[model samples]
Target: MAKKVALLQGNEACAHGAVYAGCTFFGGYPITPSTEVAEVMSVELPKIGGAFIQMEDEIAAMASILGGALTGAKAMTATSGPGMSLKQELLGYACIAEIPCVIINVMRGGPSTGMPTGPSQSDVLQARWGTHGDHPAIALAPSSCQEIFSETVRAFNLAEKYRMPVQVVFDEIVGHMRERIEFPEPGELEIIDRTEPTVAPEDYKPYDTQFGDVAPLAAFGSEYRYHVTGLNKAEDGFPTTKAELVDAEQRRQIRKIEDARADIESNEEYQTEDAEVIVLAYGSTARSGRYAVDRLREEGVKAGLFRPITLWPFPEKRVQELAKQTKGIIVPEMNLGQMVLEVERVVARDCAVELIGRVDGEPITPTQIMDKVKEVL
Candidate 1:
């Protein structure tokens, strides 16, 4: 198959990737830096026999997708800063209820709708802990339009495979920036659908172990019918009041990701094996950090980049090794010290962990990252 090349924004590319990944339902509200995702899906979904709904608000948008996923549809929603806040409740619900879904968060400056149109990565910690629970989170960070598309597909795949909510975390710059990209041919990308129970309906359990940590999921309208509650549930997926069942289910919810940490973790290490200073970043910041590291390398500075593609798991082991080997690590991000905290914890007493962060609705330039890299070196 011939691949097509187009100049596309990150949000537009993500919508197309969702469609290609077998997304059959989209429910979203128009929010800055992310509304394009909904607009593109609205125009394209109907053409492909999928449903695109414009909900009244971000909260409703989150609810709609969760409901649609119950019927066995591959469903998703997109949002930015304030909208992400609105969806946190349902996000928790979806997490504990063992529903499979995808969320695209095009981050912007925030506390309260700080910069609707500007670039800022002020949602790193939020994506990890926005929902008030000890539930599982699988979030991916993409740096460019092509990366956004690929990660969006991965978001759906991971969600379906694990039967949990997965997030594609990007910033306002990547969401709106137009770049030329060659899309993968349909046959080039791998698509994963959720597993179904092989047993009869009467013998099925939505949250029970089957093969791996992930349990088989049967769509609600399918021959297999089961009940699930936001409260801690037993293997049968019903609400549980017993301490033993609650403890077992909650531990399993967390262990599913922790045990599979090796498979879920991803990062790109550039010249970090023997560097005096390592610059750490993700999303659009990684783009700037890349140029900074290359220029620093040209100027006789032993600087490298260790970019985390999977943000939730935090890529701690490699970072720990780098901290032990290097003199310092520089973390440059759009928000003030969110992920830097994690770096500090992991690299405690091994090496210095420094951060250059801004939340003023402007992106940190390569020059700025280079300056930090030079200072650290």
Candidate 2:
């Protein structure tokens, strides 16, 4: 059978990917570069008997998805820099509440509406630490339109499998660029749903640990009726101030992701097996990094590219290994210098680390990365 394909913007592909992942509810407001994601969801969701709502603001949009998620629907929301800031509090709520939802954050220049129409990777750090408190975070950064689709689907799966909020982040360059993408047929990509409680209503507990690190989540309207709150919760989901219970709950929530780090981290290496210098980048910058590596290799420089698709967990182990093998790692990002810090910490001065950063609403070019690579070597 012939497959279905389309020329789609990254945002549009993200919306379609959410649909493919069985997203039944979308609650979001329009924001630059990311608005197309909400627009596409508004149109596609209804066709599948799914629901889409444009809330009054970003926080409300986030709140609506949390509500929908509690009711057993696969829910999601989309936003950009400022909108993402507005959603931070509730994002923390989703974290503590262990709600399964996806957030598509199209990266634009930031820090009080820095550059709404420009691409930036500044939010890379924000995605992991914007929300208050210590909580587990899963974020994916896909470099191209097709990857945005698959990563969006993976974001949904991770959120469901771990029972928490997962973010799909892409810079404005990829968000607005159109590219050819072949849609994955049903069953081609694995779809995961949150595990439902098998116990009876009277015996149900939202945070019951007996089922393991991630307890089965019960829907509000289902036979189960349990307490839900933003405060530190107990096994039954009720608010708790007891230190022991609170500490254990916090550790459990964080451990779910940390323990499964192997399953969540994803990266792509191009010619790193035998290279003296490596260019480490993500999102739109990765495209430039790949080009730089190819150009340098052709010129007889052993340069390679390392692209991190799953950014939250940081891919620390692989990076540490690369650090030992390579002479240096050059990080070229759209932001001033965010992800470079992470690489530095992991590499621990085992190899030279350099940065090629930009925040003038312009992307870091292959020439810039190549220059930095040459300087490092």
lDDT of each: 0.91, 0.94
lDDT of 2 by residue, 29-112 (tens): 999989999999999988989999999999999999999999999999999999999999999999999999999999888798
- Candidate with top TM-score is 2
Cα error of candidate 2 at position 325, Å: 0.9
RMSD of each: 1.1, 0.7
lDDT of 1: 0.91
Once fitted onto the true fold, the runs of candidate 1 whose alpha carbons sit more than 4 angstroms away are none
Top model by lDDT, which number?
Answer: 2
Clashing residue pair totals per candidate (backbone < 3 A): 0, 0
Which segments of model 2 are wrong by more than 4 Å?
none
Mind giving the per-residue lDDT tens digits that candidate 1 earns over 1-377?
A: 56789999999999999998999999999999899999999999999999999999999999999999988999999999999999999999999988999999999888887888888888989999999979888999999899888889988998998889999999988999999878888778899999988888999988876556689888888789899688888888888899988887888889999887797888998989888999999999998988988998899999889999999978889899999999999999999889999999999989989999998878889999888777765
RMSD of 1: 1.1
